[model samples]
Target: LEFLQKPWHNGRLLRSKGYFWLASRHLEIGLLAQSGKQFQWDYVGRWWNFIEPSQWPRDEYRLQGIMAKWDSVVGDCRQELVFIGQGLDTRVLQRELDHCLLSAQEIAAGPLAWQALPAATAFDTEALSARPTPPMAVQPT
Candidate 1:
């Protein structure tokens, strides 16, 4: 919402989807699926970085790839998304999205503190509603 404040006048954003790390959920990976105005954030899984290395892939090459993406502070956690559109102002989009990210202070406060905030995330609500609930069985008289 913050990233796309104004609708595109010259071009349209066709699609955007990817896995990203949220400062609020430091260990979990979030999948952002977007098509036009409708977009959803779903929990993908926990970041490999947070798990024990013994549970990691046995392949050395795969391990190397993961390590390569690792950051000194956040490890492999990062914001990775793809945007496809025509005549897009990428610079402006990037800047706006960056602004939506948590500040240094917020990030430093850590996930525990983030969880303490009331209604701090919309993902949980949206995800729950998106699920298909099963109908209750009725007893025959």
Candidate 2:
């Protein structure tokens, strides 16, 4: 809701019968509620750089080698997001995000502690897909 309050905010938040998706850019930060019960935040900072098709390894073994070589971090679990907008307040945004990150103590607390966070409500996916679509009216000649 804080994001909607922004003066330059011009985007839509769509909620289907059983689906939720965000299609926005320019610092819109689209949020999606998975199955209306849980929010999937898996792709926070992980991304792949452009690699030429010709340069790509031909085999699985070679592919793994290339991935390891190019990726400084052994595992590809890092945050890397791009923000594009006019009159953007980068510092404020970064500071807010930094504050939300897990502290050293929190990280050490383990997954059990993290699971205690709030949960989302579940919705009926079948009902959403089975909903009827309106037919177009025929024009008279």
Candidate 3:
């Protein structure tokens, strides 16, 4: 009976269709990708329709939502923004490809990385300045 209280508050009034989830997901990454998180390969695929040339509607809709949000924030500059959107799209596609190429099962079945194991990354800080700075001599000492 409480559902009658407000049309906006009810979960039933809300939708369950997961197609729109991309829009929300896109918002989180689109801006970051545009800002230079270019190597992100994690968000490449949400559906298993990779063999098809057609894009998933959710993916398309997600990009549109990203564009919409970008437009709202930076308006009246169509030409420049279109180029930016294209760049973003390219980055996202590259990420998907990278993810696919890295997974070995996708390569054979266990995931691509599992098949051709990549070398572990070195985390040493040898690149940083190791020389210790001498304390400035006391003014009058």
| lDDT string, candidate 1, 83-120, tens digits | 89988898877886787787778778888887654334
Task: For candidate 2, give the lDDT of residue 67.
Answer: 63
Native-referenced Cα lDDT, model 3: 0.25
lDDT of 1 at 94: 81
lDDT of 3 by residue, 1-141 (tens): 121122331112111111211111221111112232222111222222212224323476654543453344322111111122322345553453244232333335432333233221110121113323222211100
Which tens-of-lDDT digit does each residue in 1-141 have in candidate 2? 223234533222222122111111111111223332332321111112333346544788756654663455322222334444455566775775365455678667655664443321112122225443222211111
Error of 2 at 38 (Å): 20
**Best by TM-score, which number?**
1
Residue 112 displacement (Å), model 3: 8.7
Off by over 4 Å in 3: 1-32, 36-83, 86-106, 111-116, 119-141
Q: How many angstroms is residue 27 displaced in model 3 relative to the true structure, after the best TM-score fit?
A: 22
**Ranking of all candidate structures by their TM-score, best first:** 1, 2, 3
TM-score for each candidate, following the candidate numbering: 0.74, 0.38, 0.17
In model 3, state the lDDT of residue 65.
Answer: 45
